[model samples]
Every structure is written in structure tokens, then in C-alpha cells.
Target: MPKTKTERVTISLCPPVDLGGEPGWIPFDAPSLVGESLRFVSGEPDGNRFRARYYRDAEQHLHARIWFGPETEGPPGHAHGGAVAAVMDEALGLAAWAAGYPIVVGNLNVSFRNMLPLQKVVTVESRVISAEGRKVMVHGRIFSGETVYAEAECLCITIPGK
Candidate 1:
């Protein structure tokens, strides 16, 4: 006996979600500014590792719409702490770059608040809090609505003559 053909349904675990549409928000291209050095996190736009879109608000603060994919899982069904830290590392360092500071992250301090669920779209907001001589301080947080997942403070040191 021959088996009949059945329909195959393809469902995406990480579907495209809205970042935001508020006024004074402009799209930002990280690769255009810092080249391919950001390939670690924002490299794969559609890959299972991570998917992120960058933006800037009216105040020039850097914000990102990041999706935690299945590949970033650590806990049974949640994203790993290291994955969250990676997002902070990139986003905060990029925040300094976006603020017209050519620098590298010297120290990254990440504090995990809540475990992040995989395949969910979350927001990471960063701003250059202070800049004095060669040291630039940037703070950021990863959250979904009112639920905060992780927060980080990045200290960036300006490169000489660049």
C-alpha cells in the first residue's frame, strides 16, 4: 500500500517582530560605521545564532531589537547568561562608537536580572553616560516591555589617533 502525501507546515521559531515605530527613531547600520568587527553578534541577520537590528533615537541613544535564537540557549528553554553578555558587549561598545568615540571596550560588567526566554524579541538600549579624556562610560539594558533581563556597564578606552 502506498502512503498519501500530507501537507508540511513550516513554522519559524523566531519570527520577525516589530522593533518600534515611534517618532524620531532612525535606522542605524553598524557595519557601515565599524566595519566587519561586529560579525560576532550582528553578523548573521537571519542566522539561528542571533538576529539584531540597530536604531538611534532623537537623543542619539543607541537601541537594538535583538532576537534570542535557539542556538543561544543555555538553560533548558532559556537563553544563556553568556549570550546575554555578548549582546551587551556588542551593543554597549557600539554605543560608544555611535557617539563619535573611536574606542574599544576595556571593561564590561553585566548583571543578569532575569532569565531570557529563547526566540523572543527584546530591546537593548544604550547611551554614552560620560566621556572624560580617553575613558568613555556606556550603560545599557536588555528588556521586554517592563521585564528587565540584564543590564551592563561598558567602559571604553579611546584609541590613539583614531
Candidate 2:
């Protein structure tokens, strides 16, 4: 028996299905969109204390875990506000992708609230709240061991070419 060109596949449904009744259709020979599979293929940086790990939750919200070490320290043993902002920005980018929106930061607005401690395992979380066409609104927070160091709100746009 020979396997036909036709294939059987599974697709995830979105809040509102746009591509017919299916959300994502996997073909026998190729991938339509670069989704979770792409994330795993291109994992986050490693071998550094100040590394960020990216993950996607069951609800499809983007999540990241990071650590800031001595190299990234400022003010003698404390993390810099700019460092905190960078972490938040990464999370925001992942959030856009998880929400079926792949985007580039158009305008990022970050607000600092407190100090972040260096050499501690900091965490960042983000998600997409709203979107229109290629434009999306992303929000995220940076935390130092349960204490919030900063928050962010970004206006981003998805470049359709991936």
C-alpha cells in the first residue's frame, strides 16, 4: 500500500476562527505557520546566569523566566532599570506570538516602580490584551522574587512575513 498525498492533521481553534473552520492546518510536507514548533527549535539563550527561558501556557499566554547576574548589575549589587525593561520587552514579544500575532515593537513604554536585585532569579510574564489587523497591544511585568520591579505597555505591529 502507498500513502496518498492527502494527510491527516490537527489544528488549534482560536477565539474566532478565521481560516475556515480550522485554526491551524498541518500539511503532510510543510508547516503553514511558525508556532510552538518554531519556539522549541529556537530555544532561548543558555549557559549564562542572566538567561531568559520562554514558555507557553495552556491558555496560550507567553511566559519567561530570567536571572540577572553580576555582569548585568548596577548601583553595586542591584539590577538596573534598563535591564528590567529589556526582560519585559522579551516577554511582550513572546506574548504577541502566542496570541497568534507575530509582531515587532512599534513603541514601548516602560515604567519603573522599584529596585531589582542582581544575582536573583527574576521572572517576567506577558500577554496580548487586544489586537487589530497587524497592530496589537501587549502588557508585561518584571518581578524580582515576587516583588515587581517594573511594568510595561507596548504598541506593536505584526510583520506578516514572519
Candidate 3:
């Protein structure tokens, strides 16, 4: 009998709070697509492959403590580029929302500086760079201490109604 190879992967994450002590880190509440608060990614019951807790720093920037789990792996032990982009998309878009713009991302540009390791915690920081007419520009980075993993710029457009 031959052993079967499995393509299915299981993801696991350590709580962000256990990684570091975040000051003034408050839970950000955003309307969920399912009419509840945002939960797992792609509606996966196990958990979000990349779990992020949003916050507002003392300087009023949109900040997030994110964990990349095994489910997000792209290369061996590194997280997939799409996973990083997804985190940036949500974080940058949320930045626009936190700035009082009811918005949806029009375009999202991401630059991968380095491969992010799986099962590690990183901080995602975002700021609304500018707002002109319906376009809102947001910049963000994913980093752990001094190492930068990725950076992103998101163009957001205001929704018709809140």
C-alpha cells in the first residue's frame, strides 16, 4: 500500500498579545460582511490564516498586530505574497475608514521587501496620506522590530452611503 500525500494544510496562530505589549491598542470594530464583526478569512471556521487586530496608536495612525500562520505559507516556511497583500488591503482600507472616510479600495499596490516568516507576529502600520475628491491614498508597512517585510499603497474611494 502506498502512503497518500495530502494537499490540505492546517493553519495555527499564536495570539498577538503574547508576542508583545501594545500600548493604547484598542480593538477596532468594523462591520462584517455577514452583518457581524469581521471574523475569519474566507469564512474559514478554523481561524484567519492571517489574524490581525486593529488599533489606533497614540499618533492616531491605524495599526495592526498580525500573525502569519502556516496556512499562509508560500515558500517552504515563508508566508505567501497574496497573504501579505490581503493583510495590507484590509489594514490600509481600514485606515481610510478610521480617518472617517467610508470607503472601498480602488487600487492596492504592494511591494514585497522580504519574505515574512510563518507563525511570527508583525506590526502593520498605516496612515492616510492624502484625500482628494473621492480618492484616498493610504500607505502602510509590515514589520517586525527593525526588519521590514512589505509595504503597500492603497487608493480608496468613498462609498455612496455609510
Candidate 4:
């Protein structure tokens, strides 16, 4: 038998800021509230797919600092629209949950503003805008500074009896 050489690959990741240390922001574990069902988009905190962390501000507004890895790329050097939508879906629904409404996303409408570049950490800010009966409306945007990548409106329906 002949001996073979092994190869190693190293990947550099750019994590988001430490929101837990930032004033007026409190970090949270999404899985604790929503269970492991949300692990798809936020499953791997330091993974090659997507890295996400959740926080709540002084006003109790849910915010997420997310990084889209190379595995999420669609158009050369950018993230896929589906990837963007997945983030919106998870973040918005989680927003409703954080607001004390146990719900599931009934409908989601996302408008693509600009193509998101991969490997960069972006902020997803979400808030429950209105709640009428079982309907909960959440508005959120994915942006980095002045660049708005996408905006989404999620209609969540409260789980029966929850």
C-alpha cells in the first residue's frame, strides 16, 4: 500500500459584535423559546452555512446579527434570495414569539432591495407592528449600515390556545 498525504482547509469567519456587552441590549437563546425547529437557519452559530445571534433591546425589540456563509451564495459572491427569505421567515416569526405571542408564520412577503454579499455580518431588525385577534403582523429589514438588502412583512397566526 502507498502512503497518501492529507490536506487541511481553514475557513475564516467574521462574527457579529458582542451584543450581550452592549448597553440596552440583552442576548437570548432562540431555541429555548422556539425549540430546535429554528435550527435550520440559526442552527450553526459558527457553521459554514449561516451564523445567527438574537438580542432584545431596551424596548424589547428583537434583533438578529446574522452572517451568511459561502454555502448561502447564489449569484457570484452574493447570497441567494431564498437564503435572505429564510432569515426573514425565522426572524420575523421569532419576533412575534418574543413579543409574547406563540405563533407560526401564515404568510411572508419579502422585497429584495439589494443583493447581499456573503461573509459579512448584517443586522435583521424586527418588531410586531400590529396584532388583531389571531393575526400578528411583523415588519423587519435586513441591512448593513446604509445598505438595505431586503425588507419583509410577516403575518403570523397565534397558535390555538397558546
lDDT of each: 0.91, 0.63, 0.79, 0.91
The C-alpha stretches of model 1 lying farther than 4 A from their native spots are 1-21
Each prediction's TM-score versus the true structure:
0.88, 0.67, 0.80, 0.88
Q: Top TM-score: which candidate number?
A: 1
Give candidate 3's error at residue 11 in angstroms. 8.2
Where does the lowest 10-residue lDDT sum fall in candidate 2? 21-30
Candidate 2 per-residue C-alpha lDDT over 54-103 given as tens digits, one digit per residue, 9 for 90 to 100: 55556666655566655567778887766666666656766776677767
Global fold similarity of model 3 (TM-score): 0.80
Model 3: residue 141 alpha-carbon error in angstroms: 0.2
TM-score of 2: 0.67
lDDT per residue for candidate 4 within 24-75, as digits (tens), equals 6789778999998898998877777888889999999999888898999999
Stronger candidate by lDDT (1 vs 2): 1
How many clashes would you count in candidate 4?
A: 0
Best by lDDT: 1
Tell me the spans in candidate 2 whose CA falls farther than 4 Å from its real position.
1-49, 144-146
Clash pairs for candidate 2 = none
- Which is the winner by lDDT between candidate 2 and candidate 3? 3
After superposition, candidate 4 runs with Cα above 4 Å error: 1-22
